[model samples]
Target: MGKIVGSAIVSHHPGLMQCEDFRRMMGAGQDSDLIAGYERLRHKIEAVKPDVVVIFDSHWFTTGYHLVDGGAHYEGVYTSDEMPWYLYGVPYNYRGHPAFALDIEAVSKEMGGYNRAIAHSGLERQYATLNLIKHLRFELSDTPVVSASSCQNCRPEHFLQSGAVIGEAIRRSDLNVVLLASGALSHRFVDIDWKPNHPRIFHESNLSSPENLASDKKAIALMQDGRHDRILEDWDSDFRKAHWEAFGAHYLQMLGAMGGAECRAKGEPLSAYENARGTGNIHVWFDA
Candidate 1:
């Protein structure tokens, strides 16, 4: 049986990687606390020493079926199309595990999650995985990695089932695996015209509104109390706004892969941030 040593939900905004440049662009205070939280996660990762790190990216939208990054050599120069000004010409080099990509595809097919392969050069990984890799010490050659796509037409149920298949694939393999759910909690944004030194934005960011804060707090509490089922049940409609990122599918994958019923929140906050647009960033660790 395969072993799962670590699992977490993280924010992969390009701003996280280019905090200084982002601050220069947005004219916001330095986010020292948010940096500390991610640093803590980095420490935990080193302790885990996983053989493979599987990333579930929110920005990677596949239409018909789930997709996996199947390229064995992941070396590329990344320039974010969304925010090229902040993250331009960033070099990312890593090793990929193509064999396990096929393994996950087979297991996903068995679990009714048809999987596709994205095996080629010139395809840039989304910031969700790239930002985290930039901060953490896990390199491609040191520890091979793979990425899973978030199907645009999928529901929370579909994501959960796909996550189960991924977990099963990890179990049948000999590698020690760690999982990452990379996305934002509340992803709504305001107008992009906000200049530097805006009063509404700061280190300890206030949530967009009280309702957004409450919704995010409740979501985190549910995770802390080991209420994975409630997340699966109320996510699509409740505990979230219509604009929340990935429809909370990122958390569903983390919850499902770690151990569906057995997964529980450790009441430990990994990282939390509210961007200028009122998007809530959360990083939580789930016990397998």
Candidate 2:
């Protein structure tokens, strides 16, 4: 039976797409740890040698159904509409695991969950998935990738159900998979006018508010301790109030795949927790 060999919660903020010199300049002479964290994450992934990487793309927001990119292959130049200037004209070419995606759909149906696998060549690509591909240098390897979208209309429980479907599908298949939750912690962005006043945009002090910073830190601590149960328990009362990226579905889905509240996978920090325009970003690897 196939199984999840590993998983991670990674940052896909547009700032990471910039050159090292520019990134350092913005960070007051320090490069975003996410830059070096990619290399470290690459080593972790290589050690497991997964056949496919399933990305829970927080940026790819679908309306009613959970969509899976089932294309046989993808190749083209991508430019982010959200931040075109920072992430423009990026070339990407990668194989897709259509069979595995189809399996996820089948399992979803059995579980009465909403899921669809689309192989349309015209489907758009988001930076959440592409950025990781570029940074991890997936082009240098043969591992195929498939991206799953967050259903914007769903609540936390729905995302967890989708993840359970995916987990069951993976277990039924023969592909060793790595799950990547591509999103941020507290996702409140700074107002446009605040940039001039907060020049140190990458620093923790610049996070949206003290509450957001504390919420992110608490969540991170819980993750490190393998206490996802507490995080989920406080989702509505605490973490949700801080407004996690993509409503935090990226993380909930990934956790669901790993056994949800029952999961006790310890997370190791691959990069220091940092700020991205008031949002909480980090690279954390969860041992499977």
Candidate 3:
């Protein structure tokens, strides 16, 4: 089998490529800053130059657990640019142009059995898989790529199961595997009120104010004080209470991918920022 190696995690926040602070973090270059975080990540990937690249994003799917084998020939459901979903919803465009879309409903139906992590609703297995396709279509446009074959009906017991699927794919293919898990750390929507004992409210809000660079500093202080674990366990309700679910699916996905059976959790925050809207965008990664 080809060497099973090289993994990465890239933030999908539109602000990542747009913000000056983020660029500064990236410019840190191998020392004393968040960019060095990615430098270590790159070295890990280089050590295992995987050929079969599997990029998984927690935000992609809508319903069920899904997987897209990039090497397979599969039919995808397309939603046009004129579709209502794009008008008032989060519009995903690639390279300055609109793109074809896939339906998560199909994938969810294809993959039976679901998990209800949150009390009200959560991403179904099918939706997650379909979202991956849409994300890949937009992120990797302008390339000659085969369509993705959807994987359904698998309820991952834990994050390890997710990695096992990728590992199995690598064992089956002639190419080395590059696994990408995309998600953020402690960010929440504008409406989310983390309700820390002493809330250090920054100017206006962190979501929409691009000028408010100090909020991230506050977040770091909160983190340094060892308040992050509470955020992790209570994030589902506390963070989601603000109007959106903290996308921890990617965290779980990465755990499942990297750990498999012998996986233990070791984590670090790579980058953190709040948009003009006060929504926090923090990139975190874990190792097993």
Number of the top lDDT candidate: 2
Q: Of models 1 and 2, which has the larger TM-score?
A: 2
Which pairs in model 2 have colliding backbones? none
Question: Which order, best to worst by lDDT?
Answer: 2, 1, 3
Better lDDT candidate (1, 2): 2
| TM-score (all chains, Cα) for each model | 0.90, 0.98, 0.45
Worst ten in a row by lDDT for model 2? 193-202
lDDT of 3 at 181: 56
Error of 3 at 279 (Å): 4.6
Residue 68 C-alpha lDDT in model 2: 92
User: Each candidate: what lDDT?
Assistant: 0.74, 0.93, 0.38
The lowest-lDDT stretch of 10 consecutive residues in candidate 1 is: 195-204
Q: Per-residue lDDT for 1-288 in model 2, tens only?
A: 999999999999999999989998998788888899999999999999999999999999999899999998999999989988778999999999999999999999988999889998788899999999999878779679999999999999999999999999999998899999999999998888776335555778889889999999999999999999999999999999999999999999999999999999999999988888889999999978
Q: What is the Å distance of residue 9 in model 2 from its true position?
A: 0.2
> In candidate 1, which residue ranges exceed 4 Å CA deviation?
19-29, 194-206, 265-267
Look at candidate 1 and tell me the lDDT of residue 272. 55
Task: Tell me the tens digit of each residue's lDDT in model 3 across 21-50.
Answer: 544443332111333344555455445543
